[model samples]
Target: MSVRPIGTDDEALERAALRDRHLDRARTRGAVEDAERRHRAEKDAAAGEHGIHDVT
Candidate 1:
């Protein structure tokens, strides 16, 4: 195994915290995107558009 020194507790904790925060924001953004997709589908359907391949 490599002999690199282990990081301090605070440094590891900070990195983990940052990673968690980023993941949380990504999840939130994904949810918003899903809702937007649904809204767009409904709007398109109202206008007589069908299928994701509709280009007009």
Candidate 2:
């Protein structure tokens, strides 16, 4: 495989930056979804303890 010299390619730098940004966004989204899921589960458990039924 041929290795291109770093700091000499503008297009490669831009593509790498874009890829990093996309990965960061995906990680953030997954964290948020996980937090929401845990919160919902806890809320459901609490309601169940009190004999409350979720309508939705």
Give the per-residue lDDT of model 2 (tens digit) for 1-56. 99867665887889999999987897777975787889999999999999999999
Question: Model 2: runs farther than 4 Å from truth?
Answer: 1-29
Model 1 residue 42 CA deviation in Å: 26
Error (Å) of candidate 2 at residue 23 is 13
Cα shift from native, residue 23, model 1 (Å): 0.2
Model 1 alpha-carbon miss at residue 2, Å: 14
lDDT of 1 by residue, 1-56 (tens): 88987898999999999999987887777975787889988888876754445566
Winning candidate number (TM-score) = 2
TM-score for candidate 1, residues paired by index: 0.45
Q: Against the true structure, what is each candidate's TM-score?
A: 0.45, 0.49
Each model's lDDT: 0.81, 0.87
